[model samples]
Target: MQTHARRALATFAVAATTGVLAFAVPGAAQADAGPSTVRITEWMYKNEATAGEFVELTNVGAAPVDLTGWSYAASGGGPGQVPLSAFGEVGAGESVVITEAPAATFRSQWGLDADVKIVGGVTHNIGRADDVEVYDAAGTLVDQLAYNDQGTGTVKGPRTDGVSGEPKTAAALGANDASQWRLSVAGDDDHAWAATVGGASDVGSPGTSRFGDGRDPRASDGGDGGDPGSGAGIDPHWADVRINEVSSDNGDTPVGDAIELVNTGASDVSITGWLQIDSGAAASATPFAAKLPDGTATTTIPAHGYVYFSSTKGLGSGGDGVKLYLPDGPGGTAGTLVDQVSYTAGQAGTDEGTDFGAGAFARCPDGTGDFTSVAFKSFGASNATACESPVTDPGAGGGSTLNCQPEAPRAPAPCPPPRSLPRPGPAART
Candidate 1:
């Protein structure tokens, strides 16, 4: 179904170049500045046979948006328009799902208590390319997305088989730019679509307002609406920090297998209670070290600062995995995984096959780029420059090691002398 309202690729390119899609309303003091009211945050036209397809809309505005006359249609206008008037209205920061699945199925799969408009019989184009358009009662185009298997606009390629299109961040520029979208990750809770419907993997956060992996824009705000020191509206989570370098194969000196972390966030992050887990072919992840062993308040990573942790356990010269967890309390728990990277033996990047390599996989663009091989390893230093020489023992030398002491050091008690004389004297007196 092709629509005449389809935007040209050239127009989107221009808009992206000029940053026009991110235009803020004059004097509008909001956290983000893209869509003012309702936006198509996520949508999935393809799914397992009985799973059903859905289009999720999010109310980004501060006030409720009436759905009295809002409608959605596919490009070429084949499936016709699905009127949302029956749902009444969507409150601020809320989401609504328009699906062909039964209400029970939709609720079970997404675990959403929000409005669900079930449109049966209408068949949306599930082909390589299609369009989703949303319009108000006044016939004004609110938002439209035209996706294709062949890279279109800012999107690099087609959506993976089971993956749904999700915004990279909450403040995504617009649906016009493919770069603003990413494949959804598995939700933290079991209520995820993947958990209910058996599939390749749970690829979208259907019910949650933000991305399921906690990559949502709101997560960056530190849970404070708009605090000054709260990362300046940026989430200081694991995604803000990158695993810049990893030395998996340190030969005999296992401690040399260090992992370098860099704070790519806008503000300093206190990693006082963070834990690093090394899962070596083990199904269960074990705590390998702590970011702040002493539990001191001074353990912080300044904005863009670098910190290296020498491995206490040997990392497989072959395939191995490492995870950074942010515990809710003093020590991390199973649910506190912040960031994870898994590499195959002799390969680079994570288990997903991204940025594959050997020796040390260092970030190409320092803190915020893809990981690649470094000619020379840099311990406790910037990854901007190529390694001049091999780093043999990252912790053994003068280089600073991440203090992994399980407890704080205490002064030894003075040895007690001649306790036997007191015991004999006490027995006699008794």
Candidate 2:
């Protein structure tokens, strides 16, 4: 979805991509996102009913923002666009709204299924729920929102006919807009993005956000709390793993490897009986990697020090498809597992383990599951390591350093059908 953030004097758009098509502008970073000198204070309803409610986009920027020929609509559904050319240029901090219908008739005309956005040439829509964002002029994002059917807030309507307190007040908007929002579940990315009090924003909340504890808005019932990172007691800890080297031709499995682990947590995590591997599964349904047997592995995680492990000679020759399993903890089932990186056999060098990229995975040659690089800034070393083992163990010590063969790319097979894990629906705002 698109998200826009307002700066002190500028606003930039956030770009997202799907497949080969890139949506929004490219290379726009938060830093590049200037400022929005203007801020949208609140939604103004023409009538007691919010059906006629219109968003006021104030230009707090230094220069005037052209609203000429601009169009606005509800995100979900409605008449295509509402022209704003008649409204003209919105001076810095000056408010302008393009409402196409009368107050009482608004809902009948451009109901809630619609989205309101700035449209000139390209089409961009705001997030459907709370803390959601839409791309601003510069493609930045504005967040921190409250949406419909909130557990902690009030809900507004199809349109409230009763005239109450100051309509634009944050409290009033929260009360009214809250119910108007649709309940939503946290996405797999563990995030939820939706509308706030203002239709001008594209900001959305995340699964971990205080607002992400409820149910899907579409659900007939109020809510059913599920979703990970919501309440499940998986303590958030940072673990660093490194890939020193890889080997080829080890018994049945052509690909064998070793990884280093470092516990960045305050407490020592016992990985004694644990195993590790990447995501994705092969035909046999076996996870591709593991931690070496307890004796063969490093047991205690010395706070910030490092631990190491080797795949159980089962990881195929290529890279990726790894996971971690701690088979001995009190609640030990399959321990937390993470994906490191995608490896290309022939393209990478031999023996010398490539450096994992930057970000969370930088410490390890294997990229973090998030796919952002964290370590191995070296040029060639940033690539994967290709090893070829003619015989099992040369008995060579030094942490199972295997002589890697250079180059060999594996062909991907057809992916199996989609299958759901034991996971449940995402968390809702509670």
Candidate 3:
């Protein structure tokens, strides 16, 4: 099956390059039932003043796509058709950027080295509204995307000069729908480029993976055949998955600190190639490269299912921050952040230094509620509704209390006793 898919893609690429290919617009009836492998993954109509606009294309098929005389056209705008000259080929699971800027300018601005196509004298007027179309050598319409200031299905408004537009995960088939499109998130490295380009603070991710939370074109639905660097094709949207609970202050014990995550979306989510960030001074500290639970490397969380991760890194009793990051590329850079939660020792009327010694903080409404103090530790279970009330511990000169609801008449199940701290060596004690 995989070999057949690659052959079909290679045939299509040849036809496209030779100008003999007859392709229909998406949704049109076709003799063949298979979907097109090459897709318009992303586009930036606007950019900094100095940088030229660009459209990114990705070959999701199993074979490389040849581009000899392809072109981009706008149905009802100036610079009607920008013809693409010989630009070599786009390999399987690889991306090629078509830009109005010279090759050098585009590379320097985006920090891209290769796989760039330059079309001089043709400027893309994607300002407020435009009908963008991709054509093969024979002028066959491969794909068409229309956007306006009024917006369409999932996209809220017109794509301004600085921001790029991308489709949502599982919504690639509905690209024209306004609601399916979203704005790109600028990375920390983009700040310098934004300054040089002289546009908004948000710079689009070009020649890279599609920005925002869209499906990874390079990823397989469940299999692992694509690039090793690309993450398992998981939806990178943080909203789909979240940190539901945290047992950060596990009574100063190394074994009790655990982090829980819940999938709130309708579909299953993969945590493959994802990382958990632990930042704070505590009994347990975050690991340098902690991978999620797929047994060996990666795993998936079924819809509405929960996955728990325990950390040896002692979380700060007073305050600590936890972050989840998606793997960006093979270089080990932190990709898009999936979700983050922070806790302060004394905020929200909770006891100051003593809260860490008391119990865990949980979210009300389970998967989608605000974090609050819980008297009972609900690891991998539903959270308690009532907040935990703090009491002073005179022996330790601090506060300590069993996990119990403040208003509940009866105490809930008590949390396991705190593990004893390791005794100091004889030499160290001396």
Root mean square deviation (Cα) for candidate 1: 19.5
Query: What is candidate 1's lDDT per residue for 1-430, written digit by digit as tens?
Result: 1121123233234442343333222232222233447777776644233345566777777788787876677643422267778657777776666665665665555444433334433344343244566666664556755554334355332342334667666556344555566544333221122322331122355544552222232223222111112222223444456566777755422236777778777787666545565542111334444242222224566687777666656555434556554443223332233444544333321222222323576666776454455555654567666544332221110101111111212101111111211111001000
Question: What are the TM-scores, per candidate, against the unseen true structure?
Answer: 0.49, 0.32, 0.41
**Alpha carbon deviation, residue 49, candidate 3 (Å):** 2.5
lDDT of 3 by residue, 22-59 (tens): 32344332212144455666666542234566666666
What candidate 3 gets wrong by more than 4 Å, as runs, is 1-36, 47-50, 77-80, 116-121, 152-160, 187-200, 210-430
User: Whose lDDT is higher: candidate 2's or candidate 3's?
Assistant: 3
- Tell me model 1's lDDT, rounded to 2 decimals: 0.46
Best by TM-score: 1
Off by over 4 Å in 1: 1-37, 43-54, 59-65, 73-83, 91-94, 99-131, 135-142, 148-153, 157-175, 183-242, 247-258, 263-283, 290-333, 341-359, 363-376, 386-430
Error of 3 at 326 (Å): 17
Provide C-alpha RMSD values for all models, in order: 19.5, 18.7, 19.5
In model 2, the runs with Cα more than 4 Å from the true position are 1-205, 208-256, 282-298, 325-332, 335-339, 347-430
lDDT of all the models against the reference?
Answer: 0.46, 0.28, 0.45
> In lDDT terms, how accurate is model 3?
0.45
Clashes of 3: 17
Error of 2 at 203 (Å): 20
What's the count of clashing pairs in each model shown? 12, 87, 17
Q: Considering TM-score, which of the candidate structures 1 and 2 is the better prediction for this target?
A: 1
